[model samples]
Structures are given as structure tokens and as C-alpha cells.
Target: MRFPSLVSGEFVKRINRFVCVVRIKDKEHFAYLRNTGRLSELLKEGTCVYLKEKDKGKYSYELLLAEGEKGILVCLDSQIAPKLYAEGLPAGELVYEPKVVGGKLDLLVGKELIEVKSVNLVRDGIALFPDAPTQRGSRHIDLLIKAYPKYTPKMVFVIQREDAYAFSPNREMDPIFANKLKVFKSLGHRVVAYNCKVSLEEIKLKEEVEVLWR
Candidate 1:
């Protein structure tokens, strides 16, 4: 997807899950962070970030992407995951924010329920999810497991960056979520991971890659 007018900025500090401070053209401003994930590794002090002007939102600007290690651009917004997934997936009537047993699933295409996760953390060419702990993520998987007999469950990991060689669950950070993923896969559900070709112009879904558990 193509972003709006994005200006470069320096990330100062994150005030909370939704707000962050950034310096654009040497002027400080408050920016809205769309994702709630702990981005300690991605959004650091003095890190280069991309911000888009927001006239109707709570903040003046919204954070779009950030420059991580090795000049990689990581999309900070998690909402892009489901949108890209629905667009790239096979043709079907996509139900956004489908109500589930415990909570709302990301998308429901026909009889298939899919959960989309945006991945930005990568180490040694291996992409990982939930850079921090995610009990809600674990709950989603558990709920999916309970609803398996009636619906086809699938988990999609959308790596925001292009350089990741492979994708894996971050067991070190959230063991329960990782274990639940393993169980969900073992139950014959699908676990898919795909990378995106991200640039300043657009972010499009690329090819599907294998999901690495180890």
C-alpha cells in the first residue's frame, strides 16, 4: 500500500503504546503510533522514522515506517497486515474483524478464519513475531483451536521488511504464544509467513516463505 505524504524524522521517545515523540526538520512533534507492540529494537533514540501528516486524527502526524539495522524499513502500523493479507489472498468475501469465541479474528474468508500479524523483528536473517510478550495473541490461537471443528483456522505472519531470509515464532520472548502456534499447526491448521517488498513509494506483498519453528 502507498502511504500519504511522509516526512523523515528522528524518533525521540515513545510516551505510551499509542503516542510517541519525533523530531521532524529539527522541530519536535507528537506522532501517533498505530501498533501497540513493544518496539524497543526498532524505534530507538535518534533512529530515522517516517511520519505522515494527520489532520483528522488525535495527533498531528502518524508514524509510518522506521529505519532499523542495515537500512531496512519496518512498517510500524499493524493494521496493514490484515489489509495486505485480504488483498493478496485468493478471491473470497473477506469479513474484517470477524467476531470469534474469545475475541475478533482478523479476517474471515469464506469458512476460513485467518489471523494476521505484522512482523518487524529480525535477527540473523530470521524474522520473529511479538518482539514483546503477547497474551492476547496466545488467546487468539487458543480460541482458534477451540473453533477448529467448525472453521478452518490459519495464521499469517506478514514480515514488514524485505531482507528476512525466514520467519519464526519468537519463543524466547513469548513461549506460550510460540507453543500455541506449534499446537495450532500440529492440529492441521495452516501457518503461513510472507515477506513484503517495502519502499518509500509502496509496500506490496511478495512471495510466501516457509515458517520456521526452531
Candidate 2:
């Protein structure tokens, strides 16, 4: 899972509405950014970045894919999907056969296939997920277990570390996500959540981040 289009060594500005950011070097005084979700990480007020040249655009800039670990996170996602197929535990398998629990799942990972989600709301000491109600998200955990007969299913919630020192679901915002997590655990397939590391040199994101259940 290599990074598709990447920008290296540029000054980053705010990324409102999923914009791309880059530096023009000798000619301009402003940052260059594009409009695409492909750019990893939410563009913030002052994102550090560089540039990857592409065919000319109207704005003369290519999207700045997150470098370092963000790039790795993209790679990890594609790689893990297949690796899970190969090193599957009883609970994990690469069901190339593919199952459509409802009408939404992209891949059914083992017994508890999950839909990947990125969370982006954080402030003060709290982090919020979905930022909107997710009908599919709630259904995903439910289907994970429904797809299985013997064991519980799992939902992998991956988040990047921001300002907070700890992590938990934004129960107040998406109470259903939290409630469903509890239900899943009661059924057996516990909801697993983990954070990706972000920095200047590397970004390794994971649908699964190992941690203590307690």
C-alpha cells in the first residue's frame, strides 16, 4: 500500500473542507492545496508539508498526501486487509469469498468484518467521532456478530493521536456507537480501538492498535 500522490517538505496551512496544501518555492508566497479526501490527516491551521509534482491543475497544485506515518497508515490498511487473509486467527480470516452483511460492508474481516472509519473531532480534553450520526457504523458491529454463529464479532475503530492523553468513544455525541460497543462485548466480539502515530518522519495507521482490554 504505497502512497499514491505525495508532497514532501512544504509548509501546511489550514485544511478546511479537505483541501490540499503545498509550497511553491521560488515563485509564490502562499501554500498550495487541493480539494480531496486523499490527503491524509485533517488539514490543520499550520500543517508541515512538501510537494509531489503532478500534471498541471487549474490552481497549479497537486494534493499533499500525508507524509511519513500517514503514508504508512494508507499502506498498512491495504496490506493488513490481505495479511489478515493469510495470518487469520480463528476470529480473523481473509474471506475473499466476501460477504454482504447488509448493503454496506466493503470487506468482511474474519468473523467480525468491519467498515473502516476515520475520526476527526477533538478539542479540550475530549474527542468526538462520526461528527455526524452513522447508521452504517452502528449496523457494522451488529452485522459482525450476525455473520458469525459461534463467537462475537468486532469493530476496529482507528484514530490518530491528537491533543488528548487518553481515548474513548464520544458517547455523548454518538451514544449508539458506545451502546453498540457494549452490546458487541456482551455478545463476545469486543469493540477494539487504537490510535495511529503521526509525526515528521513516519505515520503508521492501523485499523487495529494493540492495547489492554482493561
Candidate 3:
């Protein structure tokens, strides 16, 4: 998706899950961070970041993109994955935030119950999800499992950068979530991942990458 005119800044430090300090034009400012995931690998001191000014909010700007190792740009907005996925499909094909048996899911394309995850953590060309422990993610998988034959549950992982060649669950960070993904795949549910072409101009779904089970 196309982004608004973004201002480039240097990342100072993350103050909390939703806010961070950034340096723009020699001035330090607080920026709102949409992604709740721990992004230690990307948001380092002096790392280049992109932000959009907020008209009226506690923070002056909102963090949208960050530079990864080797100058690769990564979209840090966790909420954009489903929208990117939906844009690729035909109109009215994807439903947003549909209420299910246990809770709400990300999307419903026909009979497919889709849960979209935003991935930005990459190491050695492998994209890993849940940089931190995610109990809610595991619970979502369980709900998908319960949906079962009534609706085909699917997991869609969107890596927010083009550097990753493959996607995998972060077993070291969240073993339960990784195990649940294995069970979901074993039950004949579909699990797919795609990498995106990210830039200051736009971030779009590029190509589907291999989902590594191990």
C-alpha cells in the first residue's frame, strides 16, 4: 500500500511497547509505534526510520518503517498485513474481523478463516515470527482448530521485507505457538507466507515464500 509523505529519522530508543524516541533534524521526539512485537533486531540506536506526522496525538509522529541490517527496509506496522493481503484479492472476496466460535479472526475469504501475522524479524535470510512470546497467537490457533471442518482455517504470515527467503515460527521465543502451528498444519489446515517489497513510497505484497515447518 502507498504511504503518505514520510520523514526520515534516526531511532533513539524504545520507551515502551507503543512509543519510542527518535531524532529528526537534530530534535528528539516521541513517536507512536503500532507494532507490539519486540523489534530488538531492527530498532537500534542510530538506525534510520521513517515516520508520518500525526495531526493531533500524544506523539508528534508515528513510526512506520525502519532500516534492518544491510540497509533493508522493514515495515513495522503490524496492522497492515491483512489490508495488504486483502488488496491482492478481488473485491468482496475477503471479510475483515469476522466473529468466530471462540473469538474474532483476521479475515474470511469464502470458507477460509484466515489469521494474518506480521513478521519483521529476519536472521540469516529466514523470517521468524513472534519475536516475543505470544499467548494470544496460540489461542487464535486453538480457535482455528476448533472451527475445523465447518471452515478451513488458514494461517497467513506476511514478512514485511524482501530479504527473507523463507518463513518459520520462532520456537525459541514461543514454543507453544510454534507447536500449535505444527498441529494446525497437521490437521490439513493451510499455512502460507509471503514477503513484501517495502519502501518509503509504498509497501506491497511481493511473492509467496516457503513456510518452513521445522
lDDT of every model, 2 decimals: 0.89, 0.46, 0.94
lDDT of 3 by residue, 32-87 (tens): 99999999989989999999999997988999999988889999999999999988
TM-score on alpha carbons, each prediction: 0.96, 0.55, 0.98
Q: How close is candidate 3 to the true structure, as a TM-score?
A: 0.98
**Number of clashing pairs per prediction, in order:** 0, 17, 0
Tens-place lDDT per residue, model 1, 1-214, is 8887789999999999999999998899999998988888888899999988887967899999999888988888898999988886666587999998767889888889888999988888888998989998998898788778788999999999888878999999999999999999998999999989888878988878878877
Worst 10 residues of 3 by lDDT: 86-95
The candidate scoring highest on lDDT is 3
Worst 10 residues of 2 by lDDT: 73-82
As for TM-score, the candidate ahead, 1 or 3, is: 3
Summarize candidate 2's per-residue lDDT along 37-79 as a digit string, tens digits: 2333444434445444546644544433333323332111222
Candidate number achieving the greatest TM-score relative to the actual structure: 3
lDDT of 1 at 54: 83
> Candidate 1 vs candidate 3: which has greater lDDT?
3
User: Which stretches in model 3 have alpha-carbon errors above 4 Å?
Assistant: none
